[model samples]
Target: MVNVFEQEDIMNTLKHMHKWFNDGLINPDAATTDQGPKWCVVSSGQGFPGAEVSWATGRGKDVYAEPFAGPLYSTTSILGSVNAISASSKYKTEALKYLEFVNTDETMRNMFAYGIEGTDFSKNEDGTITRTENCYSPATYSQATYFTLYPVAPNAADQWDKVEEWNETAESSVLLGFNFDRTNVETEIANCSLIMSRYDKELYTGTRDPEEAVPALYEELEKAGLETIREEYQKQIDEWLASK
Candidate 1:
């Protein structure tokens, strides 16, 4: 399956994904997964499961496939901001024209999959659209809801054109929001987070001693940047709680 996480949210999403796959899909012995031959078309993420330590060398076969998804700072690839503060306003219409193109007034479909026109989906002879995927429905379900920060490319296989009339044109909620600062504790958090990582894998795989390992982990985190991170987080939480 294609990646569901988008930009700035890949790291956290990968943690959940790792847990989901480890339950049954990954071959713990092989340190790999079971999605064989399934091409992983990743978008805007990084450090996918099993990439750092598994099936990379030796004669071992990959139990699953994973693609890298990062450096994805923008969808600026296909569209340009019509209201860009350029040195001159000469190209204003040119930018707007490009937006119009991707908006489906020009291209019938988006780079993301819209659907396979007829076999698996179609515009019902009744002026409505329909899809016949084995057990999923974009009309009622989607992969993007989980990671609201980014949306996966639409399925190109569908060949469905963009519904220009329905695109929710709006400003992004976080467009001008301030990002939380944690550089002061980044180093500590990284080291302590590593301990937590090991703890998670060990707890799930039932290798490390849970009682001993977990407590030891907290002790280590206490020494790591965790306390500082906690304080920072607490400050934010306190502010939000007070406001509420």
Candidate 2:
């Protein structure tokens, strides 16, 4: 990923952002806005195709979500949600058993995901679930394998099947399992992060001109040891690939 931040494609994207911001196509206060859920006519976020339903419900407005690109499986995405038992916990065995039950037992998994059956949610004759007004809603994927839970209303009963298919067919990134060991370059990483914190928000929010800001940012990053961090990442990736 050496020089990736200053690549031509990245610069072009920033330039497009600058044009949009200048033309009043983007929120002017985006760089400093603290208000949450400031509704806009359009927005982008990481989500599945059917996620628009939930988003629209939350914002009280009709919304449409279309994927800009195909899904690519990567280490970062896989690690987004995980449950880990504490090494120092005395209930490690019990925790493991609970996790196993949640993943393998359909009833337990569905209970955690959708709340009590016949109360918070009821299984429909068509195999979908009708959720009632309740405070027991949980992020389904984070709880257990999605296949174990019934689909909520408006989602197809075969939703999990489609999700499984998507996962099976998704292209895997070259860096799928390449976790960088930052031990050697911890200082460099810290310094580079500090430099990035200074300019990234303004540059990405289009508050600054990429033509001028990109070079200035890169200069500061280099001075802060970005090159050292890049070299270390490359070194680790090379070793990882060779091992594979």
Q: Each prediction's Cα RMSD?
A: 13.4, 2.3
TM-score of each: 0.38, 0.88
What is the RMSD, in Å, between candidate 2 and the native fold over all Cα?
A: 2.3
Please identify model 1 stretches exceeding 4 Å from their true place. Answer: 1-93, 104-107, 110-178, 237-244
Q: What tens digits encode model 1's per-residue C-alpha lDDT throughout 104-174?
A: 43113312234455554555443344445562234312211111111222222222222121123323432
C-alpha RMSD of candidate 1: 13.4
lDDT of 2 by residue, 124-174 (tens): 887898889854887676676777778777777777777777778789898
Candidate 2 ranges beyond 4 A from true positions: 81-94
lDDT of 2 at 231: 85
Q: Pick the candidate with the highest TM-score.
A: 2
Between which residue pairs do clashes occur in model 1? 45-69, 112-154, 113-154, 113-155, 113-156, 115-158, 115-159, 116-158
Estimate the TM-score for candidate 2: 0.88
